[model samples]
Target: MGEVTGEVIVITSGKGGVGKTTTTANIGTGLAKLGKRVVLVDTDIGLRNLDVVLGLENRIVYNVVDVVEGTCKLKQALIKDKRAEGLCLLPAAQTRDKSAVTPEQMAEVAKELKAEFDYVIMDSPAGIEQGFKNAIAGADRGIIVTTPEMSAVRDADRIIGLLEANEMQDLKLVVNRIRSDMVERGDMMSAEDVVEVLGINLIGVVPDDEKIVIATNNGEPLAGDESLAGQAYINICHRILGEDVPYLDLRKKKGFLAKLFGKN
Candidate 1:
């Protein structure tokens, strides 16, 4: 593939606690690290958490709802990241619900942002309700995040089906929190197994790392680090830029340590 121009992509996971916000924050930061102008928008109204993931929760004065409601200009709602100079965030409203905005409004906002940035990343809320519809309305593609567990995979499958039904042809998968040792010991699903079940193009496979928790607590993104999960996020960002990267080998070893520890 050639160098990708500006593209709008929604990072969505049908179920909650599947690392959707973290995927958004890290991928945005990773693209910014490559010197690309990226804008991350939070579409999880009322239960907004993207701001916290990016460590800009306190900086959000205006939000996406504000822009859609004409309460503030689009530029006024953007919070620039301190670390990634080329990255910005459009936070979600803490007081609003899914009813506060419509799909057309989201498409308009995305269309507006696409004029200036090289990438527009939307962090979608869980479920297949109006919120999901609103989040995916204006996107050129999607990055579906899921864990190795059956529940997350099931939800991801449903999300993929919905995207396909909407004719969103560029949907990709990101298997987050992969337990490498577990896969080796036949405990968890391998990346190949996930691809087999989803039957979709794979973009990334991020390992479950303690550093992610640490980074979250520090309000920093793991994309800046070279941890197992961090590298995966960075690679996915490159792939979004149309770069081809071989999938990382997460199931390389299985020994006593693997048996001593529990599988994720």
Candidate 2:
């Protein structure tokens, strides 16, 4: 509604398959649901999927590389989300690699998008390479998404170091795909364990839910939905907006946990 000078936030994971793109889609949609203008930039060039996750892949006539290379206007490359009113997507060029756009060019794009939207969320590619660099180039803040695994936590720590080295200190963490039963059985790490290892402020913890797979397959973000994972993302949005929302209790029901892990 009101004019907003957007804040560019990069959603990154040093390791792939940790739901970084999913987090971007949901957070952008969540912000839109909160009446904020949100744009999701897919910076994972050559392997772009944010558009797919948001179901805007078919509508993408131009890509972020086009905007950087002057092949199209910034607005022309942005595909609007059909479900969320104020949500848009600046998809990456599928045919081109990360080298197609430099960090400076990505920063310029972020600037242009921020001038119009309330929040510009960039979905960074996996690994600490040029794509990751470009993703964080225009970001005012960063959120690292990881699963409750040692490998994911290790990568997240590396990402945090890189982000802080870039002088972007406002970082947050989201632990995804948390299986409470596994944690109860000591078969998997807990969200608290991941946080203690990464040493960052935890923004949200998403339980392992089949609904996430369904939503991804359906090209819909479950941010505002009633599912546990969806509510977790909504809580993340509220925390991003400076609300002191408490984290979700991801512990399984007593009966379910007892049945699955033989715990009381």
Candidate 3:
């Protein structure tokens, strides 16, 4: 109920197809569900997809570039979410590349948003390019998302190094698309393994569920749903809020996540 002075957190994955944008949407939605004023900023530039994932693609009259380029006000560019109160999205410019916005501009925008919101979540694009730098420019903290793959973990480590080099050391890790069956069968890396390899604080482990794909297709984030993935995202949000929510025990049988968190 008090004035919401937000913390800017960047959700990034150095490699593509690692669920970074999904993480941003779900985290923003989860915080809003918990009654926090949240803004999801898509810094992906040319390949903007956060708007689509949050079901706000049709409502984007202006984008982050527009706001930065002085073509529109920041308030005018923000597309409010219909499903969650106090939640809005500052979409990326699909027509422009990452070079369209500078890191200074992003930092300025983040500062302005932080003064107005409880949480400002930025979705960084794939690769350690100008887009990635722009995304993390004004972040108070960083969430590095990676799957249970060696390549993903490697890229995550590289991103961590970059963040540390820039003096942003408050970083956490989220291992996504984890398959319990594969881990049990020794076919895939466990979340613990990924965390160990990355050598960072493990915030959450999201199970690989078809529900995530369905939710994305429906332009709905799974963070507030009843699915395992949804619970995982909620747990991540709680952790981000400095809560001590326990991680889901995915080492059980195939349906263990469902049984523990209730039916999907």
Question: What's model 3's TM-score?
Answer: 0.94
* TM-score for each predicted model, relative to the true structure: 0.92, 0.94, 0.94
lDDT of 1 by residue, 129-240 (tens): 9999999999999999999889999999999999999999998999999888788789999878999999998999998888899999999998957677788888998898
Give the C-alpha miss distance for residue 7 in model 2, angstroms.
0.4
lDDT of 1: 0.91
lDDT score for candidate 3 against the true structure: 0.92
Which runs of model 2 end up more than 4 angstroms from their true locations?
1-4, 253-264
**1 or 3: which has the higher TM-score?**
3
Better of 1 and 3 by lDDT: 3
* Per-candidate count of clashing residue pairs (backbone under 3 Å): 0, 0, 0
Better of 1 and 2 by lDDT: 2
Error of 2 at 43 (Å): 0.3
Off by over 4 Å in 1: 1-5, 251-264
